[model samples]
Structure formats: structure tokens, C-alpha cells
Target: MQNLTPQTILKEKFGYDNFRTGQLDVIEKVLAHKHALAIMPTGGGKSITYQLPAMLFDGITLVISPLISLMKDQVDGLDAMGIDATFLNSTLSGQVQAQRMSDLRSGYYKMLYVSPERLEISSFFDFIQQLPIELVAIDEAHVMSQWGHDFRPSYLNILPLLAKIPGNPAVLGLTATATDRVRQNLQQLLGVADEDTILTGFARDNLALKIAHNVDKRQYVQEYLRENKDQSGIIYAATRKQVDELYEFLNKKGVKAGHYHAGLPERERQAMQEAFLFDEVQVMVATNAFGMGINKPNVRFVIHYSVPGNIEAYYQEIGRAGRDGLPAEAVLLYAPQDIHLQEFFVQKSEGTEEHKQNEYNKIREMNAFANTQSCLPRYLLGYFGEIVDHDCGHCSNCLDSREMVDVTTDSQRVLANVVRMNQSFGKAMVAKVLKGSQDATVKKYDYLMKLPTYGLMKDRTLKDLSSFIDYLTADGYLRIEGGEFPVLKVTEIGARVLKGQLVVEKRVNRRVIAQQKVTSAAKGLKLSESDNKLFAELKSKRLELAREAGIPPFLIFSDKTLMNMAILRPQTDEEFLAISGVGEKKFDIYHKEFADVIVKQH
Candidate 1:
């Protein structure tokens, strides 16, 4: 408890002589009891904001988190730092929970992670009141707002409970995403006084954000999975079904994907997260719940399967990568339908009518960006009111798009085909008619008799046509004539353009590359001369260790483990565990062998 200063903690435990950009300043203010709301970027050391003080303080620090897997991951990280940490939740049985409550009373843990609702229990409150509570940290505090992408009703109860605490514990609310509105809400509702809010602007210059098109996103991700091959990563999707589908697809494609979402059973979620942390699962397909407090420092890529709701949401999701200060890729695959995905959440919001109205307005603002003619990165940065120093030149809008051509003639043919088909056709069927493809609908229209622009538009793919149609809707050139999935109706603008009265263009459409065929660790890893020797030795030792532990060989170590062994050449048991893939099971078995090999100098 004596080393509360960020300086001492960083030097002593973490062996770091200095703090990164805003770390020292934020930690200093936090220790000085500033009720701070920090908007640090992803890869920023957000955890250290609370952790330094938690280590320096007298009583147990309680971290209120949204996800249980996050709790365990952070606990594991803190434990690695040699700090006492534990997580309490429904995952703990009544007996185990009772025992942990006793441990908390005995001050056995320096920090504890508990769900917001679990802490709301009267008995839990009584126990909490008994403890020497030092700090109350809220990870992902933006979620309390009804407008936040990952809102939780349980988070609302924290305000009242913090009020009742005998000691109004110094509060630290950390999130990677927060608008001026959400930030203001956290300040007022969470007792974070206006002056106390630390607005460390969200800007990570280290990350190269790119949006790629034409490649199948699944295939694109597969290529990323193959090329980066051994690096740690997470792929985010908007839906649980996407999470499940992407998880299976990635696995089928050969990436060891750990599918994680709130819908999974607690045990299953924990097991999958543990596998990821242990490096048994090289990639995770998850909703946002899989991140928040999970601290894996060397993650090299964060792929978004759909457009995240806003820049704040986008920054937080992508922030999970490049945390280790290495070059990392943040690939976002945004199809035209993605804007609707977040829009769905906006329309489904539950709160005061005023709150819902505010959320709806934000959703509309977000839509404007989705349909903007400016740089995509600039549009994202502009949302947070930050001016981009230069056009990033890395986003899809910059790389994938060409100048939109006057597709008036193309639109005429598309519209004519739709009109000829009684306006009953989807965009795909209509597109085929323009390309002169004699498919079911094109033949049904056998209206090849009227192949307007047929074969003239063969260069355009369905995706290209979709993008044109999408922008037409956004640009007020055309409207979906019906409800969701409506047939297109050329608008007054479209008619004007068709008649050559007006001229316009939009960004050319692009497609996401699906990940390439999944290649396995054994398939892609060609061990160098030294690496092959190290792998053989590591594998032999691992097999022996697994037999002794009576577990599967892979249960002891993975290909990633052997790979790390070849790269790091650790000289001690302590150092061996510090390598990314070496977990408890492996360390227990192959530590001496790996260390002996590292020291062998062969």
C-alpha cells in the first residue's frame, strides 16, 4: 500500500522507468482524488489510470465491469504483475462466493472485479461497507447512457450505491468511446464533477486504420489470419449470429477462433476467453463484451466485420489492437447495410422519451457520415470534434473508391429493368438484367428484348451496383419504394439526372475480402533451422510434460507456445510464463525444459 505513486509502481513492479503520454498526469490526478472521466484512446494505458492508485491505496479497490470474462482476464493480468486480484460474480457458487466475501473481509485481495448488480445486493453492500474500500472504478462507463452502444440497465444502480457508501470512494470511470453528451452524462450521473473530467482526446496515431473492398471480408480476414498468422487478434461483429457465423467460418478457414458473446453460458464464455488468453485460441470472434477489461498487450489486429455505431465505438473496438506499440492493422469491412445495423439499435432504444429522441438524433448524425463525400477518417474524427491534421489516406474512401462516374445511363437501365419487371425485383435481379445475364429473373424478364445497357455494364459487379443504389438513396436521387428491402424508385433528382438536367456522383462501391482458406499452425509455420530445432525440443518436452500432467499434449502448449519459445529464448521459469502463449498448464509442465533449452546455447 505504500507505493501509490505511479512513478514508484511503474519502476518497481512493471520495470518501466517512465509512463506513456497521459499516464503520469492522469494517475497523479486520480491519486489526488479527482473524480475523473478519462477518454483515453485505445492502446492507451487506461488500466494503469486506476491500477497505480489501487496498488498504492489502503483498502480493496472494487472495479465494476460489464463482462465476467473481462473480469477474469484483468485479474490474470494483475496477478501476473504480482498484485493480489480476484473476481466475484455469478460464476462463483454460493459457497465460493461466501469464501471470497470472507477473503475480502480479511483484505486478501488488493483489487476485486464485481458485476454492477452483484454489488447492488444488500448483503453485498453490508460486506462492502465492512471492507476498507479505497476506489470504485467503472470500466466502460459510457455504457450507462441509454445512447451508448452497449447500454446496461444495471449500470444505472451504481450512482445510488456510490451515494450511500459510507466513504464516497474516489471514482474513476474509464472508456475508449464517449461523445460530449455521453461524457457529460457520466459526469453528472456518476458524480464526476465537470472540472474533474479528464478529456485526453481519443487519437491513436500509431494505428493505421484501413477499410478494404473487393475482397470477401471472410476471405480477407482469412488472408489476414494467414499472413499475420501467429499474432493475437479479435474480430468484432454487430450480432450474436455474426459472431457465431464468423467464429465457425474462421475456424473452418483454419484460424483457431474463439467465439465469444453475452449469449453464451458463463462457463463457456470463461473457457473460451481463457483459451484466448492462454493462446490456445489464436483469434476470437466476439461482440464488444469480449474486451473492456481484458488486457492482452501484444494483440496485432482488430477487424470489424461491420461498421461500428460511431467513432467512439469504432475507436474502442479497434483500440484492442496495437496495444503493445507494434504496428497493428484495424480493418473495417462496411457494406451498405451496416448503417442500418446501428440504426436498428437506435430505433429499439428504451429510455425517457427525451433520451430516445437524443439517441435518434445521434443515429441520424451517424448516417450522414456513412453517406458523406469527405474522407472517411476525417468524418470519423470530426464526429468527436477533433480536426484531422491530414487526410489519413488509409481508409476505404481513400484507397478503394474511384471518382463516381455519371451512372445516369446505368441508372436508367436499372430502373427500366425494375419497371419492366413490375418493380417486384430485388437489386440483384435488376442488376443481372443490366449485365445481360440470363438467370431466373433475367430470363423471366427474357426482356433481353429490352436489354438496356446490357453487356455495356458487364464490368460492374453486383456490389458496385448496390453501392450506386445505396448512395442514390442517401443522396436523395432514389428511394426504396417499399419498406425494408424496398424496390428502388428513382427520385426527382434521379429523374433530373436521367434527363441530363443535373449531374452528380458518389464513391464507387467496394467489397470486403473474405478471409482466405483457413490454414493451420502446422500447415503455415515453416520452422527456420534454429526454429525447427527449438520446436522439436519444445514439442518433445511438451509431450513429456503432458504425460506427467495426464493432459493432452496441446493442453500443455500450443504451436504458438513453441513459436514463442523459438522467438524469446527465455532463460528462466518466470520469464517463460511472460511469453504470450505459456499459461498455467504449460508452465507447470515444460518450464524447466524450455528454460534449459534457452540456456543451452545450442
Candidate 2:
């Protein structure tokens, strides 16, 4: 036992040859009894950092997580690896909870998972008072910061819980999303030093981010579904109504789909989630309420049916795809009207004025992400404080072959009109005025109709002109102010463009093109057509195993591992153990079954 090392444990228990970019460093910090904050991208193997340490330490590791689904998935995964792990949450009955508590007192589990809300219970606190907890891992640590997008008041209980723990366990905070401000707040709260904070980066190389600016979302989704018929994906909408409508539309199209939202009954939601996870459903149409702790590794795409309220939420939502390290697509459908729903949410939210303003700023940034012509991943990375100079070369903006047209004159017309109208009107009125509408609202402001800026872009339709105004706002030439009753105002940069000091260029025919099929980077290791067939056979065997075990298929073995088996065709026990994601226990339990299939296939 004294000879055990993290590297040795990585290969023997987790069956990986090496650590990911940030895993080893974070593990080393926590092993040295320092509080470490790990900010790696989703699917960058975060759990291994703590899971490995739990195996080395003599005492139990207490994990504080916010999502019950996440805790369940992880506990199941660990149990499948022949590790002792259990979670106590609302899902269990009082008898079952008491039984688990008794086992925990007897040191039956090496890792214990619970929510911060559970820590507030006096009975749970009393049970923990005597346990020898050597390490405490806080998942979704960003929830502790007020500035984070998903701040929860219950998360404040974590600090007090840590203080009450007996052994002064080394703390490890894990989060995939955090800005500079949120990161600073986390460091202060967790007492992690600057040197111990590990940020591998927020960019996911396998995700191709794209935005469909002002398109028929239903038509686009229909066409996309037809193109990628066999793949699993998720579609996110801004509201429950949109989720139901989109689900109905897909169902009518003869799509195998399920819908989930907070409004649904608990059992129905769980059933829908299980259907998606068990591979009975190909698509899950849901709001942001879904996908937080879901560990489905084969989700090939994520489409935002409507824009999300902030970049953090948008980025985290897309991070759900490509968790298996496979290539995935993230498409956001941007309609100018979608901004209103987000704005309504912001105005009705309870917060300090500064927090509301920050949220408004985030909305503007999310809007910009949808409309900007720059590299999509670059824009997202920059928002999270990771600056990269190179364009990702695969995003929608980079691959666009359309001609560029100078829209400086059209932009000048719009910015000049905002100034001429005293900057008091919203986007619709400005577009109406520019298109020379003779409606009562336009007529009531008699001076607005008489201005030279009126009828300036009469050749374009009101919808086209309004979309162009949104483009101007997205590109930073114009700004929208006054939250609910937003008024268009010329920004400093817009002032320069209006003064003819700067020029604007836009793609002539702006549209969302269908994403071309991209081979997973893992597949670049090479799998022949026959290899694909064998991979399918192995996947069937995995599904059978998972069903027998009553767990999600990925927990049995990820798609990436199956692909490796197909390509490698491991023929012996040692060879099978050499496969990535094949730990000693997994090799013991299922190696011969997979090996028999490989032999029969050949």
C-alpha cells in the first residue's frame, strides 16, 4: 500500500495511460494537503483528481455536490469500478437513508456524496461529527460566488460545514465555468492560494460552435434532424412552452424524442431522462433544467432553440455534448425577439442593482456571441479570460465562404437615426421609422417621420432592417439600454462609425449552413469500415451488460473505449487490460465477454 502512486493508480484503477492536461497538477496539490481549485473544461476528467486520492487516503472522502443526478451517476460509475461509494439525497426513503447512515458509520464506503442542503440537517451533521473525513471535494464550486450565473443561497452552508468537520480535510473545489471575478471570490471563500488554482482552459477542441442568426428555427431543426438521423443530441429552449412546442413538432415529424422541464411531474421527468439515457430516445427537447449532472457520453450535438440568458449558462449547456472526447456540434438559433424573453427574466429577477446590471451585460455578450463574425470558440474563450490568438478554423464564421459586403453606409444610416430620434426609442420603432412606416405610432411622433433618416433604408424590409440593427448592436457599433423598455443608443464605437471614422463589413447572405460531418479526433487514430461494424457489435454487448447491471451504458464503458477495442482487437488478458478505460476490476468482470465477441467478429 505504501508503494502506491497516483500514476500507478491511474493505470491500475482507472485504466488510463496518463493524466489529462490539468489532472495531475491538481491531484498533486490536494495530496500535499493544500486547497486546490480546478477549472478544467467539462469531460476533462475532473472526478479522477479526487477519486484517485480517495483510494490512497485511509479515511473517507466527503463530496459536496449540488445536483442529485450528478451524484447518482458518479456513485454508480465508481461502484462499477469496484470502488465503495454512496450518495444520500432526497431520492432515498427514510429507511434506506438510515441504513446507508449506519453503513457510513461502520466505514463501509470510501467516498460519501451529499448536497450542501443536506449539511444543514442536524441529524446529518451529528453523524459526520465523528467520521474521519480526510478530503472534501466541492463540485460546482462556482455556485458559492454571488457573481456566478447559477448562484444559490444554499451553497453558503458549505463553509460552515467544512468548519465543523473533525479532521480539517484538504479541500478540492471543482468547476468548469468561472470568470475572473467568480474565480477570485472562490479563492477567498475556499482559502486556496493563487498558485494552487489550476485553469487548463475553458475551450473544448471537439465542439464546433455555430450560430444561426435570424432563421426559421423549426425549419432549420427539421432539416438538421434529417441530416443527422442516427445521432443522439439535445435541444434546449428558453421556456417550457417552447419545449412542449418543439417536442410536438419533432414528434409530428416522426422523431423519437422526449421533453423535460421543471413544470413536469417528478416521475415523468425521471422517466423522460431515463429514456434519453438508456438510448430509447434519440433527442431530448428540454429547457436548462435538464443536463446538469447527466453523464451521457454520446451526445453528438446540442442546439439552442432559443438564445440563453448569459454566456456562462450557454457555454456550460453546450459543454454537455462531446463529453466522451468525440466531435460534437453546438448550434444556437438567434432571433432578435428571443432577447425580450431573457430581458423579461432579468427585470423580474431578485438581486441587487449591480447584479442585475451584470446580468444585463451578460445578455448583451451572449447576443454578441450569436451575431459576431469572429471565430466562435475564440469569442467564448475570451469571455472566460482565456485569450487565444488563432482562429479555431472550424467554426461557422471561419468556414463561411460567402462574400463580404461593406455595410458602413447602412450602419451609418442606423446610428445616425438613433441620434436623430434622440435615442429614446427601441429597435422596432427605429426600424419602423427607417423603413418609412406610416403607422399611428410613427405618425404620433410627427417629427420622426419628417427626419431625413426616415425612409433612409426603405429598400429593405422592416424585419431585415431590424435584424441588421441587432447585428450592429452585436458588433459593438450600437448599444441597447433601459432593461425592460430597452432604448437604442449609439455607443462610443457607434459614434465613430456614424462620424465615418470606422467601417463595418458583414457577410452578404447571412445564414446558418448545415454542419458537415466531422470525424472524432479519437477516430483519427484510425478505424476502418470493418472496424466500425465491430465497434457497433461491441456497443451492443455493452448495452446488454449495462442493462444487466441496471446502469447507463457509458458507465459500463465509453464509446471511445469500444472504438479502441474494435481497432486494437485485444486477444489476451494482458492485451485487454492495456485498452484505455479498462481497469483491473472491469477487465476481470467483462473482458472475456468482449474478447469473445471480437474473436467471433474476426
Candidate 3:
């Protein structure tokens, strides 16, 4: 026990040979009784930092999780590794929770997972104080900051609860999607110094991000599902009604699908989630409610059926895919009207004026992500404060092979119109003024109709003009201000463009470019015919083992591991143990069964 280090624990327990990026650094800091905030990408092995330290420490490690399903998945995964961990949440019956608490008093578990809301209960708080708590790990730590996309009032109770704990346990905060603002707020609130922040960058290289602007979403989704029938994915819609409609549409097309949203009954939601997790359903059409606690590592894709309110939410949701370090796709189906729903949400939010305005800014940012023709991953990573100099050649934009045209003349027209209108009107009105529409609103303002910039782009349709305006705002040539009737203001860069000091270029409208067939094979491993057959057989066998063990198939073996096994064809215990995900426990339990299949195939 004294000689075991984090690396050995990682291999012995988690079955991985290396510490991914910042994992070891964070673990060393926590083990030294220091406070740290780790902002790694999703699937970047963040849990290993705290989970491994919890194994080394003599006392219990309390993990403050935000969702019940996440806790269940973590505890189950740990149990699969032959570790002692349990979760206490409202999902359990009163009698069961009481028994678990009684066991907790006896030091029966090494790690106890609970939501921050559980700490607010007087009795549970008193009970936990008596435990020998060594470290506190906060998952989804961004929710504590108002600047974060998902702010919860319940998270405010965490610091007070920790202050009352007897041992003054070291605190570790982990989040996959935190902007620089969110990170600063978290660091200040957690009393973690600037230098102690461990950010391994926010880039998922295996995800091929695509934005299909103005395409028939229903048609595109149907084609995508039909082509990738073997892969599992999640389709995120903005509303319960959309989820139901998309689910029904896919069902009508003979696709086995499930739908989940807050409107569904509790049991129905649970059943749907279980179906998706067990691989009985390959697709889950859900609203935002479905994914936070989801730990399904083999999810091959995550398609945004509609635009999200912010980049953080979008990034976090897309991060759900390709968690196993295998290639995945994140296709965002965006349309001009899709942004209206998000705008309505911002206007209807219960936050203060400042908060609401900030939300509006985020909506514009998300819109930019969808509208910009630049590298998709670079735009996403830039929003999170990591500046990657080169283009990610894998995104839709980089792969579009369309010719670039100078839009500097068109840009100056829009920027000049914003100034001509005194920058007091929204995008719709500005586009109307630029296109020289004879609408009553424009006709009523005689001065507007007589502006020098009016009818400057009369050759372009309103839709094209509107899209171009969005591109301008997204690329920082213009800014959207205020909440409800947000007006466009020209940026400093826009001024430069107007003064002929800068030139702008954009890809020709996608309608002019011939569309290529989007396929998952381009992003994932290209397997030979025999290897593909072997991989399918391995998956079937893994599913059988998972069902027998009452766990998800990924807990038995990830798709990536199975794919690697198919390619490597490990036929001996030593060879199987040399595989990437194979640990002693996994090798002891299922190595012989997997090796037998590989031997039989050869």
C-alpha cells in the first residue's frame, strides 16, 4: 500500500497505462493537500485524478456530484474495477438510504457520492461531519459560477457545507466546459490559485464537427441514421415537443429510437435512458435534460437537432460523443429560424438584467459557431480560451473545398448601414434597410429609406442578407447589444473594413457548392472486411457478458478496445494483457473468453 503510486493505481484499477494530459498533475496536487481546478475535455480521464487519490488515502473521499445518474454510473464503474464506492441520493428508498448511512458510519465505503442538495439536509450534514473525510471532489464545478451556462442555486450550499466538515478536506473541482470567465469565478470561489489551475486544453481531436446550414434537418437526420445504423448516437433537440416529433419521425422511418425530456413521466424517462445505455436503442432524441449524468463511453455521435442557447452548452453536449477516444461526429443542423427559440428562452429567463444580457451574448456566440465558415473545432476551442493557430482540417469548413470570395465590399455595406441607422436597429431591420424593402416599417421612417446605404445590396435576397449579417456578427465585425430588441453595433474591425484598411473573405454560399455524402467511416477507423466482422462478433459477446454481469457493455469493454482487439488479434493472456484497456481484473475475468474468440477467428 505504501509503495503504490498514482500510475500503478491507474493501471491496476482503471486498466490504463498512461495519465492522460493533466491527470497526473491534478492527482499529485490533490494528494499534497492542495486545492485545484482541472478543466479537461470530456473523456479526458478527469475522474482518475480524484478516484485514484481516494484509493491511496486512508479516510473516505466525498464526491459532490450534480446528478443521480452520474453517481450511479461512477459507483457501478468503480465496483466493476473491484473498488468500494457507493452513492446516496433521493433515488434510493428511505430505508435503503438509512442503511447506507449506517454503513457509512462504520467506514464501509472508500468514496461516497452525493448531490450538493443532499448537504442542505440538516440530519445528513450532521451525519457526514462525523466521517473521516479526506478530500472533496466536485464534478461539474462550473455550475457554481453565475457566468456558467447552467447555474444552480443549490451549488451555493457546497462551500458552507465543506467549511463545516471537521478534517478540512482538500477540494478538487472538475468541469469539461468552462470559459475563461467561468474558470476565474470558480478559482476565486474555491480559493484555488491561478497557478494551480490545470487546463489540458479543450480540444476533442476525434470529433468531426459539421454544421449543415439551411438543410432539410429531417431528411439529413434520416439519411445519417440510415447510413450509420451500427453506430450509437444522441440527437439533442431544444424542446420536448421537438424530441417527440423527431423520435416519431425516425420511428416512422423504421429506426429504433427513444425520446426523453422533462415532460415525460419519471419511469418513462428512466426506461428510455436504460434502453439507450444498454444498447437496446441506438438513438435517443432528447432535450437538454437527458445528457448531464450520461456516462456512456461508446456514444459514436451527438447531433444537435437545433441550435443551443450558448457555446458552452453546445460544446458540453457534443463532448458526450467519442468519449472512448475513438472517432465520432457532431453534426449541428442549423437553420435561420432555429435561433428564435433560443432568443425566446433568453427573454423569458428569470435572471436579472445583467444576467439576461449575458445570455443574449452567448446566444450570438453560438449562432456564430453555426454560421462561421472557419474551422469548427478552432471556433469552439477559441471560445474556451485556448488559441490553436492552425485550422483543424477535420471540420466541415476545412473540408468544404468551396472557393473563397472577397466579401469586403458587402461587409462595408452592412457596417455602413448600421452607422447610417445610428446603430439602433436589430439585424432584421438592418437587413431590410440594406435590401431596400418597401415594408411599412421602413416606409414609415422616411429618413431610413433615404439613407445612402439603403438598397446597397438589393441584388441579394433577404435570407442571404440575413445570413450575411449573422456571419458578420459572428466573425466580430458587428456586435449584438441589449436583450429583447437587440441592436447591431459596428465593431472596431468593422470600422477598419469600412475605412478600406481590411478585407474580408468567405466561402461561397453552400448552395452553390456540390454536397458530398457525409459518412462516419471518414472519421472512424477504416477496418478490413474480416476485422469488421470480428469486431461485430466481439461486440455481441461483450453484450452477452454485460447482461450476465448486470452492467452496461462498455463497463465490460469499450468499443475502441474491442476494435483494437479485432485489429491486434490478441490470442494469449500475455497478448491480451498488453492491450490498451486490459487490466489485471479485466484480464482475470474476461481475457480467456475474448482470447478464445480471437483464436477461433484466426
RMSD of each: 20.4, 21.2, 20.3
lDDT of each: 0.72, 0.88, 0.88
Model 1 off-target regions past 4 Å?
Answer: 1-4, 213-215, 309-311, 339-373, 399-602
Candidate 2's displacement at residue 538, Å, is: 68
Runs with alpha carbons beyond 4 Å of true place in candidate 3: 509-602
lDDT of 2 at 590: 87
Give the lDDT ranking, best first: 3, 2, 1
- Cα-based lDDT at residue 445, candidate 2: 93
Instruction: Indicate whether candidate 1 or candidate 3 has the larger TM-score.
Output: 3
Clash count, one per candidate: 24, 0, 0
Q: Cα deviation in Å at residue 251, candidate 2? A: 3.2
Q: What local lDDT does model 3 show for residue 397? A: 93
In the range 177-258, model 1's lDDT, one tens digit per residue, is 8877788888888777776777777666567777654447787888888998889998999899999998888877778889
Best by TM-score: 3
Give me the displacement of residue 122 in model 2, in angstroms.
2.4
CA lDDT for candidate 3: 0.88
Model 3, span 389-474: residue lDDT tens: 99999999999886787889889999999999999999999999999999998988889999999998876779989999999988
